[model samples]
Target: MWTIYLGLTGLAAANPQVVGLGNYTGALEDPRFLTSLWLTVLYVGGSAIIGQAGLGFTLAGILRTRTGPVRRLVEGVVLLSWIPPSTVVGFLWFALLDRDEGTLNALLHTPGFAWLLDHPLLSIIIFDVWRGTAFSMMLYAAALENVPPAHLETARLADAGVLQQPRDVVFPASAATS
Candidate 1:
């Protein structure tokens, strides 16, 4: 083990020196890099903050008490978003958002509108939200479902509705990190 570790260390030492910070500085000096950074921030804010955490929480809360075949159907559809590959999600979004022959543009009959070129950041954000929000919703569903019965009963005794109980008890409990 010592010999192997020494060999690995020697191999690493033999590699050419790489100035990681210099590369970062060079990239940061480029206008394209700044634009990319802005786009990345926009994507994260729009999809993760606004779409996933916001809308996903609402969907989970609304579906929490839903039962029967309709609930199952909804679950199935939502699970599809969670189960597919990210690349597949991107491709599907591209198909829908394509300029000339895209499904959305065709359905809306909005000719000459290039979704990809005109709204690259927004397009990616929408695709990411569509693909990733299901996981957040499912997580919220599980968290809400696993609330302690005693707390729920206490909330019930206090005349809290299902919605109120989750807000007052379950959400805080599940959101807390050790």
Candidate 2:
């Protein structure tokens, strides 16, 4: 672990010289680095914090009450997102977002609009939301499963609405998993 951590601080594989912290200082001074860092924060906040977590919790709540084909179909779609290899997922996104022959352009009838180049940050954030939603969904589902029946009963006795019960009981209990 120590070796791996130390290795990341040194030179690139192409460069023979080991410049400890030199690359870090250079990156800190670069304007492009600052832009990239801001974009990274946006990507994480938009995709993971808001998009995935919110969608996952909503799916868990909806699917838990559902039965038969509806539940199966929803689960299958969520599972499918996680089943593909990361490389394959990346290629699929690239193909879908391609400017000339991309699916989006074809559907919209607006070809020659380079989405990847024109909106790289947004593209990556959206891609990440799509890719990561399954994990959060599964996590929330498992957490919801472990919620005690007493919580629901108490909420019911109090005449709490459906949404309020989850906020007061289910969500508080499942907060750790999320």
Model 1 agreement with the true structure over 1-178: per-residue lDDT tens digits: 7644543342356673444355557768999999999878887899999988877887887787688898888878877988978788778888888888799998999976899999877877877787778888888888877767687789899999867986898777777731
Highest TM-score among the candidates is held by which one? 2
What lDDT tens digits, residue by residue, belong to model 2 across residues 104-126? 99999989999999998889888
- TM-scores for candidates 1 onward, in order: 0.69, 0.75
In candidate 2, stretches whose alpha carbon ends up further than 4 angstroms from where it belongs are 1-33, 156-163, 175-178
Q: Which segments of candidate 1 are over 4 A away from where they belong? A: 1-35, 149-167, 175-178
What are the per-model C-alpha RMSD values against the true structure?
A: 6.0, 4.3
Question: For residue 91, what is the lDDT in candidate 1?
Answer: 81
lDDT of 1 at 4: 40
- Evaluated at residue 13, the lDDT of candidate 1 is 62
Model 1, residue 51: distance off in Å is 1.3
